[model samples]
Target: MRIGCRQKMKSIIKSFNQQGFAILHGVLASACIEAVKRECEKLVDELATKLLALGRISDTYDDEPFEMRLIRLYENHPSETPTIFRRELHLRGFFELFAHPRLLTIAQAILGPEIRLYPNYSVRPKLPENRRTEVLWHQDAGYTSAEADILRMVNVWLPLVPVNVENGCMEFVPGSHRGGVVPHEKDEYYLRIHDDHIQPVVAQAVTIEINPGDVVIFSNLLFHRGLPNRSDHVRWSVDFRYQDATQPTLRNTQGHLLCSKKHPSNVVRDAVHWAELEFQ
Candidate 1:
């Protein structure tokens, strides 16, 4: 069984190299899927209960000021609160999803066995009309200028919920990875989304959809975005970016650098060691 899994993973890695991305259908076993579902559900229930107790569920952020909104919730929230918004939420038991045996094997094939976490693991849950935060078409490197040019980053986007085109599924321009880095403006990103900055080298744009337990691995340089979720339901997915350990990360405002790992061996390293970029 283990050898079969390894062979399948090798094929997926080969496909990823040929193309910029590959979707592994039903990569997670049924038991693992159920475990993830239960863990996420429990987190929601706990959040609801805590909100009810402190009247924070629906109104906590409603009255807060802009600076307050920008405050890092991962550090501010009680340690018990499940970290949900990307960088800080190191979903404890959920490590299996990112470091799954088969998934890591495939990653090893692409990134070498010495794979290092990108220090920016995040879960983006786009609630219906949640402030127009859909990322525009741009290379992920444009967002992480601190890294060297030779760096090859891979983002593994695993959706806990089945994602489709209408519900903010990821859309990519095929063969965009071949273009490498393209100049991007601050206005074209999360702040003010636009397509004029992204030169379309690939004539056809592909909408990627996946079921639960499926994973989409793509080059970070590929042009992609979380399309606007027109549906009433929320789109939930976690993006785990990985790169070689020797990359340089940018420093933050507090004189502290991010992703500065000395060991870079463990999957659960602190955030100060991962590379991060300013969101303009």
Candidate 2:
């Protein structure tokens, strides 16, 4: 059953507050979508060119038989990695997508009035012919050690292209939040530390197909992952996590400073880890 606008917004807010996830369908209008798509294409082309010039395009460690759109230029060329955002290319314009007013407003509403922006922001592009491994299901918390209760972190996933179930869109287990942090399977991303079920209930599955510019909001504790991209076109998206001012943070999380108009201010404390870190 379709719902009225006011009711829909209320439900969305409520759902996110309770379950730590919410999908705002068609959040980005067509024009903004086009703008982001074009910018992403241009950035991808630029990054790819640089990598090729540097002779760094071998095969990604996680590289399987899948078609790869973006090859983690920074991951391969860590020496050239930018210092601005989390493992990002130091591309300011591209990182701006995280702080887009509409995206932040929704995050602010859920994370509380004051939030601190993590310096870590990134873009994931699943290119045509890039079909290797499935983005194993996991929670954002699996990558961090922040306080679970006081933390008000929200990850905003903005798709640069239309996302559908067939082409490896994200799938969420509705009400999975009630289960708390389930143990995850340790693979390439991060190993499951706690003893939780590997397979979550499929009956509650809800695949979200978002158009360009649409944003999906979810917490770090939610169980989610990107499906395999089977489409001929590339699937591109960016992510940003925000924490409430009262929560703890990783000082060197991604090894970047946490200050940008595009970043949030709601944070708790900041810490650092010397061990190698992957995406958060």
Best by TM-score: 1
- Ten contiguous residues with the weakest lDDT in model 2: 266-275
TM-score of 1: 0.72
lDDT of each: 0.60, 0.58
Model 1 CA deviation exceeding 4 Å by range: 1-11, 56-84, 146-148, 188-199, 249-280
lDDT of 1 by residue, 1-280 (tens): 5898768776776666666788888888866666555555545545555665775444334343311221222224433333256433444445556557776666666766556566566766655444444666667777766453467667788776778877788887766677666666676335321355454443577888998788889887777777776765657777876665454444231211222335444434432222232221
Q: What's the C-alpha lDDT at position 137 in model 2? A: 66
Per residue, candidate 2 scores C-alpha lDDT tens digits across 1-280 of 2367557767878988676678777776666555555555555566667767777775332332112345354454444432112343343344345445656566666765555566556666654334333566677776655445345577777776678876778887766655555555567544543434535465566788887756788877777778877776556666677766455575554333233344434221222221122333
Query: For model 2, what is the error of residue 10's alpha carbon versus the real structure, in angstroms, after optimal superposition?
Result: 2.1
Model 2: residues >4 Å from true position, as ranges?
A: 1-8, 51-86, 89-92, 128-133, 146-150, 189-200, 254-280
RMSD, one per candidate, in order: 8.1, 8.2
Error of 1 at 82 (Å): 12
